[model samples]
Target chain A: MPQREGSPWRGLNVVFFRELFDHLTSVRMLVLEFLVVLFGAAVVYFAAEQIRNTTAEDPFLFLRLFAPPGQSLLSFVVVISILVPIMSIGLGFDAVNGEYNRRTMSRILSQPIYRDALLFGKFLAGLTTLTICLVTLWLLVIGFGLLRLGIPPGAEEIGRLLIFLLVTIAYAGVWLALSLLLSVVFRSTATAALVALGLWLFLSLLWPALAQMLGGVISPPDIRFAQLGLPTPDTLAWQQGLSRLSPGTLYGEAVVAMLNPDAQSMTTLLAQFQGRIGSPLPLDESIVQAWPQIVSLIAGTILLYVVGYVAFQRQEVRA
Target chain B: MTDNVIEASALTKRYGRATAVDGISFTVGRGEIFGLLGPNGAGKTTTILMMLGLTDVTAGTVRVLGHDPVREPLQVKRVVGYLPDTVGFYDYMTAEDNLRYTAALIGIPLADRDKRITSALERVGLQDVGHKHVGAFSRGMRQRLGLAEILMKDVSVAILDEPTSGLDPHATSELLEMIRSLKRDGVAVLLSSHLLERVQSVCDRVALFHSGRIALLGTVPELAREVLGGGYNVEVEADGEGLALRFSEIGGVKAVDQSGPARYRLLADRDVRPQAAAAVVNAGGALRRLSVEEPSLDAIYNHYFETHGGQNAAA
Candidate 1:
């Protein structure tokens, strides 16, 4: 690398604050916030109602608000996994290209700052916005749980919930980075948005099924496991591994581990039945179990951001 | 340290196979208004970008205030202000807010920001509309706002690309006057434009760009002399006995032609208006009109291109 002259972060705070203000006041953000809060409240309310009737003496009742046992299709966690990507994409799909369309890129770049400051500031601003939104939603869900269940969460439950919130932000970071990368790659805002939404749809809705099919082809089930009508361990591992490539899959698995402490590894459900039927695992153990997924979410975010930064640096500032 | 604020030597930019700026060289001194005159795609904007360190230089070196733009971009940018061809601001942002954002980026202290922004806006005659959203601003207003940004930065050099391109004639003259004021403030200005007549009035020196090369470089009169073969054309309209003969006998009058019944076009090495008027009145003739046509940039440009067989001379 050629030795650069000044600090790469010279004007970072300026760009960050300006972009944060824009995101906070934008009508698009208000609409997305309304939708997420509406869906989140409804899902958590239904989950809390169901938990109140079904589980009378469960130790982790507050956790059930996020991943209610009966509703596998639309739990609070599931709603978040699906909508967070959309919200992130909304914040980021036009981040860089909007400047180009407005003809402000050259003027801004001519300031005494590097391109690093601009891209980093935009990413930080988007992530901060996502954090604020998710934290608000988390608190709302907890408050609703307290009203409906009449039980304050244990310190451990709150800890796990906090971890879950961080994991959710990391997941949001993944999609935000991907959309920002698309913005840098495409000059037109419409094209960048379309491609980002298309990618979100593919990863969230179609990639899980595609991964299973591809895994079965790659690692065929053993004859002995097939004769006993049991899924082959190697084949199951391959499918899980392939599916984890999608940020949605990683987020879902991490939330499962965080919210439902009774849940163990994907291939070790028998271990759960052995001696831990009535007891939940400790928060640390749950985190250890979900460590790889958390890392993957965070790594995917950094990888995407690095790619966008490189593309932005190479781009011409003419227009 | 030096009087020159911008200096580029053998500056070149090549996009893959074709050269955009082909080994061009120039220098802009303090308080000087330099014009980069060219047609579209003549590489004027590209050259400006190279100088601001907004684009990479394929070959050659550019220094702004004795700092290399490519290697020391921030140092150069700190002292240089650039107004792009189509300058833009956030449409939803009020003019004051937009200036505030730029002020933060330029690292102006908070204590000084409002005062500087107000004064800069006042300088551009935009103080009254500072609270209005920029989306409602006219093209002339936006161009003025761009200049206000340069003024707020208090930069040593201001590089403007087509500052008055889309403005009406009234706005164009207003912008040109502001450019002249920038010169008066000891700020070097490098402005690029395809309009010759408007730019010629304000530019102290100009480099005519053609196909990525400086086809002509000098003051307007110097260019006119090199290309037009003569300095001044004195038109005298008088009626008397042998009036044309009397005017032709004046010193420095090269040739005289009877253009009309009472008009005589005198080709002169210098302005001969006083002598011609004196001769007409001295000979007891009624001098209808006596005017000197200083060599116009349009004529020099057209004549040079016509003689040189330049096919791309659209401007």
Candidate 2:
């Protein structure tokens, strides 16, 4: 690499603080934050109410606040998985293109700092905002669980919840990075935002079903499994691998491993046949099971960020 | 250390197959107001961007304050402030807040920022409206705010691109006065604009750009002498017998033409109003109006382009 004259992160703090202030105070962010809080509290409250009556002597009762059984569709994890992308995209879809449209790109770039500081600072700010939101939502769920269940969570439960929170942040980072990449790639804010939302819908809501079909075609079920009306291991593994390509799927699987300690592996059906049901694995084992998913989420975030950084650095500052 | 703060030699910029700025060279001296006069897409803005290191220099080199702009952009940008064609600010931010943000970017100390911002705003006649949001500012006010940004930086060089492009005459004049003051403070000012006449008064020297090249570069009078063949037009309105002949006999008078019944336009090497008036009176003619028209950049540009087959020289 050629040596640059000064630090590439010269004005990083300035850009970061300015962007952070803007994001925290903006009306759009305020609306999104309010929506997430409202939905999160309602889901956690319902989960707590059901848990209070259903499970009397459960060891990981508090972990169910996030991914409560029998209401998987509207649990805290499901709400976060669906809403985090929207929130991240909302904060980032116009991060760079908005500067171009407002005619501020040239003026800002003309400052003493390199373009690296601007792109990096914006990404950091968006991630920081997501962190603040996710952390607040995490605290709210735990507080609701405390108030409704009338018992302090075990240390293991707290550890699992903390891990879940970090995984959620990594999940948020993925969407933020993707939206920032879209912002750099598209010059028009409307187009960037539409494309980001379109991708989010396809990856989050539609990709799993498509992945299953593609997996089945790629690896037809074995004759023995077909006769027994069971999916072959190859077809199931292919489906899981293809679906994990989506950030949302990666986040969902990671959170399941963190929040549901009984989730032994990616092939949960196969793990169930091994005769270890209702016995939660240790926290370390859960982390080991979730390690690949977490790494994939973080890697996806960095990959998107690097792509956006390259595009931003090469872009002309005339606009 | 030299008097020339900005030096670009054989500077060229090419975008793919198209050249935005062909090989052009010029120098801006300390405290001098240098104008880049060109029509749209004539590479004036591109040239400015290259000098500020906002765009890559494709072939040749540019040095601001003796440091190469492309390589030492941070050092160059620290001392050189740029005002883009249409300067923009955060609409939700007050003017003071916007300046503070820029000051932070420049790494100005907290104790000095408020004082510098206030003084800069005062210098630009925008002190009273510092608390107002920039969204409500008029185009001219925005331009002044841009100048205030430069002044706040206390930069040695200022690059303003089309600073007076969209301003009213009054605003334009006020802005030009501010530019002159910037020069008075010993700051080198490099401003680009197509409003030839408006910027002509403030420019110490101008480079006329056409088709990504400097077709003419000098003071207005020097350009007029080079292109229009004469630097002065002495108009004498009088009625007399043999008046045109009498005026032609004066020193430095090249040609004489009777434009109206009592008016004669005399092309001269210098201001010959007094001599022309003497000739008309000595010839027993009543001199109605004797006026001299100085060389104008507008006329020189028109003449140069007209003779050079206009401004259409390939993309």
Candidate 3:
């Protein structure tokens, strides 16, 4: 066999190009981004226009409501929060399974490249495309906000917006890792996509509410007889802890903290639980405060990716 | 295993409870066009997959180019280019794009990729259609493209699972020529096919896969010997059965049978055409005509299946 010496990064570079070219030209990828853009444009245009036309005092109510004459970290996170997971799922749900279905898995596995190259290459390519799309969306949103409001973001606001971008990407990475696991587990691309969407829906919409109800049912705390029954402390704590386990909740809370540190009143609970809580920090500070959540998001993503790697390595692509 | 570039030892691959490839053993030597001949669902694809490390071996060891396919897959894969039974290409891309993609995935350097792609396309006689979308290509063209993808890597071994399966006669001939070309390049090729003619045309050596085992393994002539009981059959047109019997009693004749009213078949271990002819003529039988027929490979292949009914034959 002909052997050539090269750096390990060279391998990754090859994989990255292959995947990126595929993603760039793939019909499905085009369909997905087109739909996202169409829907996003509609949502932003109609909502902002309606609000601007109705609230005559501030034509750029959406921008001012989220951030006062600055880059609204809240607005960016909200838009990305809606867009990130969708893009991640769209990019990743079929990454491995599609290869398996196309019967290319064997041909690819028969190559000299490592499985890591395939999986990591796909993620990096998707991340690159996603970053480009998100940044463009940010510029557009900020440009429109500037045109309407005629002010740039302050230093503190920009810092918050940067943190929001970081956390949002971290959140999106978690989903990307998740979809990879599903792709490895399910041989059919459609089935993997369905399973990923199901997981996304369950975590984002259904699981938190279910956890709250479950905590209430499992251990109903004593309530004062004077007022109607309300959520008790132990119930609240159980709910909070249980919700933390849901990746969706962790991602959402992190984004909210990064965008708007005072979005929720966590101080009273911290004071009650830890007994020596300090004043609330700024939005950026809150992202630092929620380092464990960020770590958990990343750790969860990596852990799933590792599991997927092992599963794929064990798979018999001959089928 | 000593001379064989790939040695599969009692390979067995089971999916849940369904056995895909039963315990099978075989060896492929250098520069040999080894044909794994079998019908569909006969475990030929599974066997090739195991050899290429595409499937887990339930119970066996597969060594490709002196490395375990399962454990040291990258090493084996580096030296082997596999064309799956049904070659699926990225439909949206051009043939050139697909080649580039495969080359990259196989770790070919960017500078080398262009040269490899060009040469590979040319090798498959697909140079002009390089820029055409694969979705528009016919099944035969796709098969050739698949072959080009593997050839581009410049690997020492090519494992083709049913290489000429869906090709027309012309395409089949072209594909076979390509396979023959591999031998000239000193690349060992392992191809599986049910088309006897295809195999007969290109394969230097062949193995008849029956129930996941190599029932008959040898060159076409060797297999013909084992299957049809190697020898020449002498047919003599005689005047009478008595004279034919006398001819059969000749020292060199193994057996004799009356195939027709005037025709007698003499089975001999060697060429005894002259002896049989003389005996027939001296025995007072008019020898109208004499002809010799060599046993065919197809007959040998049929006898292999006939003798070995299933995997139970070994027991």
Candidate 4:
């Protein structure tokens, strides 16, 4: 770096640290983290209490805290599915346009750093912040589970939980990259945030409604079966396939199968194999089951991030 | 072995169908204050952006510190620091914090960072207020803070885009003085200002930009002589009733006009201070003041635009 003869990432460290400090101290990030952590911990607490009172034998009891343990009070997975997108968007929706609006874009570009370093650093910094936030909440849940259940998680349980933590981070990264892409595409931070939040609403609330309609067209369960209140297997498969397209659903599927080893399969086909397996599967076996869902989540995150990076690097700084 | 800090040849920049800068060429040498004199939208800022490699050159090439900005932008940026026309910083951070972040961006090592930041603040006269938030700083102070950033980078050249813009007369003068000091420190300074009178006092050489092309390039004196067709406008003052009539008869006097009791304006093709003095003495009147001046830059700019048929007036 002293001679400026290396890759463009030579200035990446400086950009990363500066952005990390900025995100850590910003009022927006602090407020979002507060809401997410408080709500996340509350859900895990209720779920942990519900699992403690279960009469049936559950081998992977600690993992059951993430999936629904009892009543419909919203499991930890459901809370995160609803909240992580908001938190990640809050962290990144102002990444590029905010700098341009403040007249700081030219000044930063004037430094020895290339556009690659700046955009990459910003995305990594935001992702790292998300990772730290998610890990802390995961630890809090484990701690609360230990206190309530009086049973420590075995090594296999810890390994599965660690993978779950990584999957959640990858899931948050997708929203963060999508938000960063919006920030680069829009010139105003308000517009970027609005569009990102609009997309979030579309995925979380409206998409499900639309999916129900599209599911009917893709696999009509036959109007005659509707009178018997029994849908065909085509409708069930299409509905599951449609929901799998959402990152939230991808994350939920991956985590539930990997975390709860007692889950034999992720589809209605589970009824065929339920009586065959009487015990929980090992951590590696469960990961093998969830590998496709995990790969899709990671690939989706990388694709979104690369799109943002390329768009930002191609952007011109007029000043 | 080259003396130039920046050399741009056949530089052109276009946005869509509109060309912002067209086939311009210039060189900024060490310790020289080169000014880009033009009106708003004259492509001065675009040229600077091209030099900094912040924008792609639509055509042509530019070499900064002997490295092509397009291909070796990091090396070029390492040696050249740009202070934008209207600079901004992280308003929530203190001045020191802002400078610290910039130092990191430039790859300044941690061991030398504190000392360098302090000296840079002291150099820009911001040391006393380094702890203050930038949001509360006035426009002029922020401008100086921008300078501090360049100084901290310790670059060989400073490309400032309208550095004196939006400042009061006093602040403008102080900034000019600061730029002068930078030149004394062996730093090549290239600044753009739309006002000729302001840059005339600081620039050693200037390029007059009209419609994205250099209409004229030379020292201030050369431009004055070439554009106004050659001469000195000499004003002579005496306290007699007939001195104006007598002073008009001096040698090499092209035209003469009388203003008051004894004041006469003589447009002389050569230096006529001595001949005019002799005539004023011979008029048997008291001599008070004598002034000689060349044609102003404003006149040269107007003549240039008119001669070019006003093909591309910057509106």
Considering every candidate listed, which one attains the maximal DockQ? 1
Q: How accurate is candidate 3 locally (lDDT)?
A: 0.75
lDDT of model 2 at position A266: 65
Instruction: Give lDDT tens digits, candidate 2, residues A66-105.
Output: 8897687879899999999999999999999999988888
lDDT of each: 0.91, 0.91, 0.75, 0.85
Report lDDT (Cα) of residue A71, candidate 1: 81
Q: For each candidate, what TM-score against the reference?
A: 0.96, 0.96, 0.84, 0.92
True contacts kept of each: 0.83, 0.73, 0.65, 0.73
- Candidate 3 residues B1-315, lDDT tens each? 477898888889888898777788888899889888876777898888777766777998888889887666677888998888778887777999878877876767788889889999999989999999988998889888988987888878999988888788898888889889988998999998887765776788888776666677888766765566645678888684476668667775677888888888887656678887778777777778989876555667677767766644554
Q: Can you write out model 1's per-residue Cα lDDT over B1-315, one digit (the tens) per residue?
A: 778898899999999999899999999998999999988899999999999888889998889999988888999899999999989999999999999998899999999999999999999999999999999999999999999999999999999999999999999999999999999999999999998888888999999988898888998878876887665799988888898888789987778999999889997767899999899888889998888987777777778878874555442
In model 3, which residue pairs have backbone atoms overlapping below 3 Å? none
Comparing to the true complex, what docking class would candidate 1 get? high
The residue ranges of model 3 lying beyond 4 angstroms of the native Cα positions read A1-10, A30-79, A225-230, A271-280, B1-3, B10-23, B58-60, B231-258, B261-298, B310-315
lDDT of 3 by residue, A96-142 (tens): 88886776777776777667677788778877777766666656665
Q: List residue ranges in candidate 1 displaced over 4 A.
A: A269-279, B240-255, B310-315
lDDT tens digits, residue span A1-319, model 4: 1243558787798889889988888898889888987887788777876776663567778778877644444788788878899999999989999888878899989998888898999999999999988888889888988898888998888999899988888899889999999999999899999999999888777776677678888888887778888877678778767877788778878987787676665643553555546567677768877888889888988998898888887888973
- The CAPRI category of model 4 is medium
Candidate 1 local lDDT, A239-290, one digit each (tens): 9889988999898888888998876655267555666664677888788878
What are the per-residue Cα lDDT tens digits for candidate 2 across B62-113? 8999988788889998999999998998889999999999999998999999
The reply for model 4, stretches above 4 Å from the true place, is A1-5, A70-73, A218-239, A270-281, B230-232, B240-254, B268-275, B292-294, B307-315
* Cand. 2: chain B TM-score: 0.94
Which parts of model 2 have CA positions greater than 4 angstroms off? A268-277, B239-242, B278-286, B310-315
Interface RMSD of 4: 4.0
Ranking by DockQ: 1, 2, 4, 3
Residues B187-267 of candidate 4: C-alpha lDDT, one tens digit per residue: 999999898888788999999987788878988768866776655789888786576666667766777888776678887
